[model samples]
Target: MTLKIPLENSSFNLDVSGIAGFFGGEESFAAMSSVHLVRGRRWLGWYNSPGSYYVAKKYGVLAKSRVWDGLYPGVNVDPTTMLELDGKVGPRYVAAHSGTRMEKTGHLAYLLASHYSDLEVDQVIPGPSAKSEAHITIASLEEFKEFEGYPKLPADHLSPFDPIATVPIAFSVGASVMCAIFGDWYCFAMIILGVVCNGVSCFVIGSGVLKIKQPNPSPHSPPGDGVLFNAPGSRVILLKGSEKIISSITRGRFFLEYKSQSQYHDIGYSSVALTMQFLLQLFIVPQGQLFGQIMFLSSLGVSWIFNAYLASVDREDLQKRILMRVLLQKPTFRTVALPKWTSLVVFAAVYLQAKPEGTRGLLEQLIPNDTAVWRLVKSAVVEAVERNKDPSEVVAERNLDHLDNQERGLLEDMMKQASIGYNAGNDFKL
Candidate 1:
C-alpha cells in the first residue's frame, strides 16, 4: 500500500500557495517511498521526486526541493551540513550561494536557521561546499520557523523507510540525539552505523539518478562546463543537459561530506570508532541495557560533533569569530534576524526536552558529587550579571570568590567571561 502524507502546516501558507499555483496536476506518490512525498501536487518547482523533497525537509531545508534540482550523484550535501551566513535577511543578515545572492532556498534556509537552531550563531551555511563565501544568516531557528511564510510541519517532520541507504544515517542521527539525552552508548553506536549507512544511501540515490541517461543527446542544448557531462576522459567541466547528472554529483558530495563530518565529529578516530561502537553494542552480552547506552553515547557524540562541526562551518560561531568579537567588545550572539541567543538556548533546551532520558542522565554529570549549594552559588554569581552589576561587582556581591576554593572553581573563569555580558544581552548581535 502507498503511504499518505498529511498537510498540517499553515505556517508556510505563502510557500504552499506558490507551490499550489504550479500544482495544476495532482501527483500520486504511490511509488514514492519517502513519507514527506506521499501525496502532493506535482509541479516543476521543488524536487521532481517526492523522496528528495522529504529528505531535504528532514535535513532542515524547507525550500530544498527547489534549491536542489534533484537527487544527483557525486554531490556531497546533507541537512547537518550548515549554511554560514555573512550578512542579513532583510535589515539583518545578507545571504550568498555559489557567489550569487541566494534567491533559491534562501528564505527556507533563513527560516531554518532562524528556527530550531543552536550555538552563538552568526551565519547559516549551505552544505558540502568548502568554499568560504557560500553562506548566509537569516535568523535564529525559533524566529525563522515562525517567519511570515514558513510552512507548517506534518507531525514534527518525518521520512519514510526506503532507499535503505539514507534510513540508517538519518536514523543514526535521530537516534544519536536520543542517546545524548539518555546516555545510551548502544544507541549511539547505532547512530554511527546509521550515519555511515546514510552515506551509502546517498550513493545509491545518486547512482540511481545517475543512470537516467537519455537515449540520444539533443544536439541543440550544448552542455555547459561543469561536472555534469564529462565524457569519461574529457577535461572540460562540461555542464550538459545533465541537470540530473549535476544533481547526482551534488548529492554524492553532500552525503560524502555529511559522512566526513560524522567522522570529523568523531575527530578522525572517525568511522573507525563507529565501527567499534557497532561491534561493542552488537557483540557485548547484556544485550539490552549496555546496548542502549552504547547507542546513546554514539548518538550524543555524533550530535555534539555535528554542533561543533557546524561551529566550524559557521565559523562566525567558531573560536575565531567568538574570540574576535569578544576581543573587540562584548559578544552578543546573533541569530540571523531574530533576538540573538534565543535560538541557541531554545535549541539546547528543546533537545533536552526531546531526550528527557538523556537529559536526566546528563544531570548526574552536571551535579558535583561532593557539593550542591556551592554550584548553586556559582549559578547565583552567573545570574548576578543580569542584576546589572559589573562582572567584578557581581562576583563580589555574591562573594563568588569563595567559589575559588570550591570544587566548581574552574567554572569561575568561564562565568567571569560570560558575565561580561550579564547585562549586555540586549546590545549584542552577530
Candidate 2:
C-alpha cells in the first residue's frame, strides 16, 4: 500500500535514459496514475496481475480472436535510460510497460526479458529491499532492428500505448504516435455484458414478474420442479428433467424454451439496442473521456438488478418453502381433520433439523430477525463453550473476587442459563 509517486520528501528519484514507442494505452487501465512529478499524491502502481488470466481466459481478453496487450494503463514506462551531456541529452528508445508479476522479482521485469533480450544490463536500479517501493533505472539499451526482421505488431516493443491515456509522450524520450488494436472492449461490449449479467440475475428473482401463465397447458397440467435455462432463446438446461426431482427423467417437470416468431422479435430488438448503445459508447469514449468515465460508472447501477432469483433459493425463507415442498410431496394427511398443536411442532421440527449446507443462501432472505441462522450459530458457539467447561469453572472460581463485575456477571449468568438450556443437568446416577 506504500504508493510511491510524486509525494513530498520521496527518498529516491527513478530516471530512465532509453525509451520509445506508444504511450496512450498506458492511461486506459489505470486512469489517474501517471509519471508526472506532483508533490504529495498517493499513486496506485501495478502490483502483480498477469496478462495470461486477463488476456487468455475465454471470457476476458481471448473473447476476441486477436488482442493487443499494449493497451496500457497510465504511465508509459520507458524501458531504457538516458544521459544528459549535450543539447541532445535524453532517454534512448524502449518498449511499453507490460503488467507486473514476472518469473522471479515481482515488478514488470518480464517484458524486458521476453521482448528485449538484446539489451545488456549497464546498471539496474532495483526497488526498495526491505520496503515495498521499487525504482528501476536502465542505463542504455542496444536495439537490434533486424533482430528478426519486423514484428507482427508494428508499434514499438519498448513502450506500449495506453487506452484513455492515448496521447503520445513529449519529445524527451522520442516516443512515437500510438498504434493500438481496438477490438470489442471499446465501450459498447462491456455495457452489453454488464446489462446481461445484471438483467438475467434480476429476471430470475423478481416476484410477480415471472407469473406469466404457461402458454401450453392441459386442463390438469403436471406440476413442474426445478429451474429452466435457455441460451440465446434455445433451451440449454431444463431442471424439470433433473434426476433429483424425478427418479426417472421421464417424470421431470416439463418446460420448453423454444422461441416463437413473436418472442424472436423482442429478443432481436433488445439485442440490437444493446449493440447499438455499446457502439455509441465506443465511438464517444475516445473523444469524451469524462463521458466514457460516466458511462462506465452508470453501468454499475444495474449490476445487481437481474440476480434476484439466485437469492430466492439462497434465502432463509426458502427453508420454510423447502419444508413445505418436501412434506407436501407425500400426499397423505389421510382422514385426520383436526390437529392444531401437532402442526406447530411439525413446522418447528424443520427449523431444528434442517442441515446448513443443504440450504445455501439462508442468509440472503434473512433480515436479522429471530431467524434460524443466528439461533443456530449462537447455539453451536454456546454448546462448544459448555463442552469446554472453562467458563463455568472460571466464573465459579472467581465469583468471590469480582462477582459484581459486568463481564464476570455475564459469564456467570451464561453458565446458569446454559446449564438447563441444553438439558445437560446431571440426574440419573446409573
Candidate 3:
C-alpha cells in the first residue's frame, strides 16, 4: 500500500541563474535539468543524472525541488558548479552549488555530496550562517587593505642639477658668447664640439639612467612596502644590508662619475688645443706646416687613448647590472667580468704615447728648432738676391750641392713645375 503525503512538506528551492549564461541556449539549460514549482518549500538543485536526487536525499542533503513561483516544479538546471549565493529567500537558506542557490535548508549539503562520498559525508559540517558573518568584496584576499584604487605608474625622474649635462652646456654657451665678442670661427668650433659631445654623452649615459628601477620589496620594511631608489641603476638609498649597499653604490658612483669626468676632459683638451692653434697661427706659425699639423693632431689622438685608458677600469655596481637586465627586455647573463688584467697593457701604451720623449718645449715639439740651418739658407738667399739670380736656384746649388745627379734633376723638375703653377695662378689673379 502507498502512503499518501500531505501537500506541506520539508522542501526548498535553488535558483540556477548564475549558470544560465554558460548554457548555449534555453534548450540546453532545460535539457540539463528540470525545475518545477511544487506546493511547499523543497530542495531545488542541479543534478548530473535523474537518479542524483535520490543519492543527495539519502545523505540528508536535499536536491529535490520544492517550489518556484508557486508552479509545479520540473527539471530545468543540472548540478554544474556552485559559484556563490545572492539575496535571501524567505526565512531560511541552504548552501549553493553548480551556481545553484537553495532556500529553506540552512546547511551546505551540495558541497558535501560533490566533494565527499557517503562514507566521508559525516566529516563535513555547516559553517557560519551567511547573515552571521561579515562580508568583504575585494579583488584579492591577499593584501586587501592596501589596494585602494588603480595603482599609480612610476614617473620619470630628473635631477635638479646634472653636472655632466650642465657643465658642457655652460661651456658651449660661453664659447658662443666669446664667438660673438671676438668674431672668430675658432670659438664657433669650440662651441659646436661642446654641444655635440653633450648630445652624444646624453644619448649613451642618459639612456641607461632613464630606465627607472622597479619597486623591489624591502626585507626591513613591512611586506608590500617596496624599497625606494633615487635613480635608475643607482644605489644611493641605504637598503637593509648596509655594507653591501654602500660598496655597490660607491662603485656605481665611481663608474658614472669617471665617465662624466673623462668627457669633460675631452671637451677641455679640444677647446684648449683649438685656442692654442689659433694663437700660434696668428703670431708664430707663418703657414700651416705638414709636420706641425701632424704633431698637433697626434697629441689629440694620444689624448683620446688616455681617456679610453681612464674609462677601462672595472667598477662593478649591482644596481647597474639589475637595470641592464630590465632594459634588455629578457633574462640575460650577469654583467660580464671586465678583463682588468689587460689594464696594465693599456696603461703602458697610453703612457708611452702621451709622455714627452725629451726636454722639448711646447712650441719646439710642434715646430722645428733648426735656427742655424735657417740662417745659412737666409745667407744663400741674400747672396742670390745680390747676384740677381733666383733665390731657390742659388739655395739648391749651394746648400744641396752634395745631392746625387738623379736627386738634383728630380728636385729641379719639381721646382720648375711649382714655379710655373705659381705664375699661372698669379696671372689668373691679375
Candidate 4:
C-alpha cells in the first residue's frame, strides 16, 4: 500500500494504505494494482481483481497459496513453485520494477503473492513447516502472453486500453466535432440516440446482474444451499444465478441503476442546453447563435470534469454523492434537476419550431424505478444477517421464501424507508 517511487537519492513513499484498507473481504483473491506517477503531482491507479480459485486451478497454482481451497478441497495445486528466482530471501528481496507493461504487471502479481501467500499457507496447510517455507509465484512474460493467445475468453488478464471507459467519450467528442461543422440537428440527434442506447444498455445489463437464481429442488439440499464463495471460510456457496455473482463480473455494476438515472439527468441537461442554442438562433434579433453553440459544447466539457471528480472519489464520498442525488438534497439536487426540467420547456419550444418530438419523457416510461433490484439485494442481505446464513445460500434457498407473512411485511416496510426515492427527513440518517 505504501508505494515508494524512486527519486534521485531518497524514494518518495506515497501512503495509500488507507485506500488499500477500504477493500475488505473474508477471503483472499488474485489482485493486480498499478500506480502511475504523472508530473510528480497526479497519481493514477488501476486495480484488476480475479477470483483466487479460478486463477489457481487454471494455472496450477499451489494450494498453500489459495485460502479458498478449504471449500473445494478436490482442486489440485502443485506443491512445487512454477519457477524460482535467484534471490528469494525476504530482507533483500526487492521486486524488479520497470517501465514495461509486462514487468509492471508481473511485479503486481508478485507482490500479491508475497503478501497473501503467507496467510493461505498458514490457513490451508495447517502445520509449522508449511509456514516456515513461505513461498510465492511469479509468472514469466512468455507465460503471461500465453493468456492473451488463449482461444477462450474470461481469461485472467489486463489490457492498456479499456473500451468501456473510452467508447462513450470518443462518441461524445466525435459527435460534438461533427455538430460544430454541421448544425444544431447533429447535437440534437446525439443526445437523443445517447439517451435511447444508454437506457436500453442499463436495463438489459441491470436485469442480468441483479437477477437471483434459486437452487433446484432437492431433498438433501437444506435451506440456503448453494456453491461456496469468498469470506468467513463457510461451506455455504452462492446459487448459480445469484446477484452476488455480479461481484465476480465487476464491482462497477452494483449501483448501475443509480448511474443510469444520473445519465438520464445528464441527457436532460444537455437537451436544455441545445434548446437554448436553438432559441438564440430563432428569437433574438442579431443574436449570437455561434456563441450559444460554443456555450452548449462547453457544458459537455464541464460534465466531463464532474465525471473526473467522481472517478477520483473514494467510497464514502461516492455514497454521499449518491445520497444527495437520490434523496434530492438541497442545492445539489436543486441545481442539477432544475436545468434538466428546463428541457421540458425546450421540448415545447421545439414542437413550435417543427422539430420532431424529443426524448423528454422516455426515461420515466423506460425505468419507472429500480425498486425491484433494491428489494432483491436488501432481502438477501437481511436474511443472511438475521439467520446467520451465507448470502449465496440465501439466494439458492429461494430468496427469503422462509419468511412468514408478518416478517415479510416488516421487511417491506424497511425497504420502503431504505429505497432510493424515499424522502430522508430529519429523523432519517444515511
Q: Specify the highest-TM-score model's number.
A: 1
Model 4 C-alpha lDDT per residue in residues 1-430, reported as the tens digit of each score? 5333123133333222122111221111111101110111111111111121232222222222233234234544221111111112211111111101111112112222233232322112122122322111111111011122222221122123333334334545554544444444533343333323322322222221111111233333222111111111111111112122211111111121223232233323322332333333233312223332333344334333433443343422322232222211211101001011112222111211211111112212211334554345345434443444443455556766766787677555434322211111111211
Candidate 1 lDDT, tens digit per residue, 1-430? 5322122222322111112111211121122112122112111111111122223222322112332223222243332232221122311111111111112222222222332233343544222233322111222111001212122223212222223323323545665565555544544444455345334333322221101111232334222112111121111111112322222112212111223332132222222332343344345313224434434344334433332322233222332222122211222224322222212221221222213333222222222233544344334433442344443454455544444465346445434433432333334332
lDDT of each: 0.28, 0.22, 0.24, 0.26
Residue-wise C-alpha lDDT for candidate 3, range 227-263, written one tens digit per residue: 1121222111111122222112121111112232322
**Native-vs-model 2 lDDT?**
0.22
For candidate 3, the 10 contiguous residues with the lowest summed lDDT are 132-141
Q: lDDT tens digits, residues 181-273, model 2?
A: 122133334344433432331121111010001123233433222211111111111112112222111111111121322122232233233
Ranking by TM-score: 1, 2, 4, 3
- Model 4 alpha-carbon drift over 4 Å, by segment: 1-209, 222-293, 306-430
Off by over 4 Å in 1: 1-31, 34-378, 381-386, 400-411, 420-426
- Which scores higher on lDDT, 1 or 3? 1
TM-score of each: 0.22, 0.20, 0.17, 0.19
- Model 1: what TM-score? 0.22
